[model samples]
Every structure is written in structure tokens, then in C-alpha cells.
Target: MAHVTFKENRITLIGNEVKTGNKAPDFTLLANDLSEVTLADTTGKVRIISVVPSIDTGVCDAQTRRFNEEAAKLENVDVLTVSADLPFAQSRWCAAAGLENIKTLSDHRDFSFAQNYGVGIEELRLLARSVFVLDSKDNVTYVEYVSEATNHPNYDAAIEAAKAAN
Candidate 1:
């Protein structure tokens, strides 16, 4: 397992750490409308799964917005931002941020997405900052488990991986 920290304090992560060659794990998450969304629903498109501790936080917001900007240029790619924030809050944040290119998903229901993706922080019940890029065939082509919860991810590398997956 990879070592993760929040505010420089170590935290234990649940589940197996995902790797680049592993098949993407399927999990259920809530859409902004409280509808159930599963990985299979987006089977045919390359996907960038942005895992954040909270959408309202500074690093999380910037991360999502960065992906939102890139989503426009990446054809057939779905940029999904997953967080444990409530669906209502996620919806409001999306509206306030004018984010339309990316989908904001809530994992508050069971934290299943966090656990399945190995980004779950046991101490805070939040996901660690990370990014995963999946090919159209559902293979994980790139994954970055950010060592610190409050930091940013490698946006350039993630974008390059998404483009290469195409």
C-alpha cells in the first residue's frame, strides 16, 4: 500500500492500491441528482477519475476545474470527479463554479468508490487525492495516488495518459 498523509499526518488507507495495469474496479456512486451511476454505464469511453477529499476544498476545486478545462479537448473521454460530499452540495458547487464539462459524483452513500479505488482514508472517511485514467476497454492505463491529501496531482501527465489512451 502507498503511504498517504493529510496535513502531513499519516492515515491508513483501505482496500488494495490500484495500479496502471489493473482492470478498473467497478463501483456505484451517486450522480448530482441522487441517481445510481456505475462504472459499466461509461464502459465505452476513456475516463479520467479524479478522486478528491472534498469538492469545496482548494486543491480539490482546482483539480476538478483543471480536468473540466481539459475535458473539452479530449474527445470521447469522460472526466468524472468523485468526492464524499453530499449530492446537493456537489450540485451547488458545480453550478457555482460554472463547471459543465466534467461530471461531479458523490461517494457519500457508502464510500464505495473510495474503498474500491484504494483511495479511502480510514481516519477521515474521505478519499485521498488521486487520479486514474482508464482506456476505452476499461484498463487502467495510468494511476497516481497523491502522497498528500492537500496537494495537487500531475495534471500534465494525467492529460498525456488520457490522450495516449485514445
Candidate 2:
């Protein structure tokens, strides 16, 4: 498991840590509309999976918005923001932010995506901040597990990996 801290306090992560070169795990997350979305649903495109604790929070909001803006210029890339926020809240945030290019999915249903991707924070019941980039074939090309939950990830590195993935 990756070392994680929430607000400078150590926390426990409750799943397997993902590493580059490994096949990205498939997960079932709830879309803003309540429909189920899986990794298989987006197969042939470079995927930028942005994991956040909550979309309504400061850091998470900025992270998602940054990806939403970046998504506009990336061709053949799908940017999905995964959070434990309820689908209703996710929809509200996206709409209010005018985030059209990125899709915000909710993992509040089961934390399936969180557990599978090793971002689940057992103590807080929220996902640890992280970013993952996967190729069209579902192979992970970049993985960032932010050391502090409140900090932003290495956006440039993740974006560059997505751009380079075929």
C-alpha cells in the first residue's frame, strides 16, 4: 500500500496499490445519472482517471476542473473524475462548474473503484487523492498517489503520459 496522509496525519489505505505497467483494474462506478459505468465501457481511448476524496472540496474541485479544462484539447482521451461524493452532488458540482469535457463518477455506492485502485481511505471512508493514466489497452502508464490528501497531483506528468499513450 502507498503511504498516505490526510491533513498531515497518517491514515490507512485499504486496498492494493496500482503501479505503472500493470493492467488497470476494471471497476463499476455510478455515473452522475445513476447508470453504472465500468472501465470496459471506455476501452479504446487513453484514460485519465482522477481520484479525489470529494468533488465539493477545495482541492478536489480544483483538480477536477483542471482536468476538465485539459480534456478539451486532448484528442482520443477520456477524462473521468472519480469521487466518493453522491451522484446527485457530483452532478450539481459539474453543472455549477460548467465542467463539460470531463465526466464525474460517484463511488459512494460501493467504493468499488476506490478499493480496486487502492485509493480507499479506511479511516475517512473517502478516496485518497491520486491520478492514473491508462492506455487504450487498459495498461497503466502513469500512477500518482499524492502523499498528502489535501495536495494536488503532478498534473503535467499525468497529462504527458496520457498524450504519449497510444
Candidate 3:
């Protein structure tokens, strides 16, 4: 298990830590339409998986919007924003934010992504702020587990990784 901070306090993360060069793990999560979506669903495309605690928060919102904008510029790439928010709430957030390119996925059904990716927060039951870039073949190329849950991720590095992966 790894550890992070929320507002400067320690928080333990539950699950296996993902590292670059590892084969990405597949997870079943709910799409905004309440449909089951898995990592295999987006095969043949470089993936940028943006994980956050909640979409309603400011940092999470900005992170998602940043990826949404970047996803439009990248070719042969798919950006998936995974959060613990419900499907309906995820849909509402995407709609309200006018995000069309990035897919909002809900891990509320099961914390499979959380535990598998090692981003789950044991204290709050939320995902730590992190971003992962996977190549078309499902190999992790880049990973950023934000040291602080409230801080932003390295968007430049993540985008560059996605570009390089493709």
C-alpha cells in the first residue's frame, strides 16, 4: 500500500501500485449512460486515464476539463475520467461542463479500478488524484500519482505520454 495527503494530512491508499511498463489492468466501471465499460472497450487507442476523488470539486473539474480540451487535439487517443461519482452525477457534470470528447466513468458500482490501479483512499473511499497513460496494447507508459489529493496532476507530462504512446 502507498500513502498520500489530503490537506497535508496522511492518507493510506489501498490496492496495488501501478508502475510504468506494467500491463494495464482491466476494470468494469459504469459509463455516464449507466452502461458497463471496461478497459478492453477502448482497445486500439492510446488511453489517458484521469482518476479523481470527485468530479464536483474544483480540482477534479479542472483536471477533467483540461483532458477534455487536450483529447480534442490528440489523434488516436481516448481520455477516460474515472471517479467514484454516480452515473447520473457524472452525466450531469459532463453535460454541464460541455465536455464531449472525454468519457466520464463511474467506479461507484465497484471499486475495481480503485483497488486495481492503487488509487483508492482508505480514509475517504475516494480515488487519489492521478493520471495514467497507456499505449494501444494496454501497457502503461506513464503514471502520475499526485502527492496531494487536492493538487493538480502533471498535465503536460500526461499529454506528452499519450502522444508518445500513439
Using all chains and alpha carbons, the TM-scores for the candidates as numbered come to 0.98, 0.98, 0.98
Candidate 2 lDDT by residue in tens digits, 76-113: 99999998899999999888998899988989998888
- Name the regions of candidate 3 deviating beyond 4 angstroms: none
lDDT of 1 by residue, 48-165 (tens): 9999999999999999999999999999899999999999999999999999999999999988888788988888888889999999999999999999889999999999999999
Candidate 2 yields a Cα-based lDDT of 0.93
Runs off by more than 4 Å, candidate 1: none
Candidate 3 residue 17 Cα shift, in angstroms, is 0.4
Worst lDDT run of 10 residues, candidate 3, spans 1-10
lDDT of 3 by residue, 98-133 (tens): 999999999988999998999988888899999999
lDDT of 3 at 12: 89
Regions more than 4 Å wrong, model 2: none
> CA lDDT, every prediction?
0.93, 0.93, 0.93
RMSD of each: 0.7, 0.7, 0.8
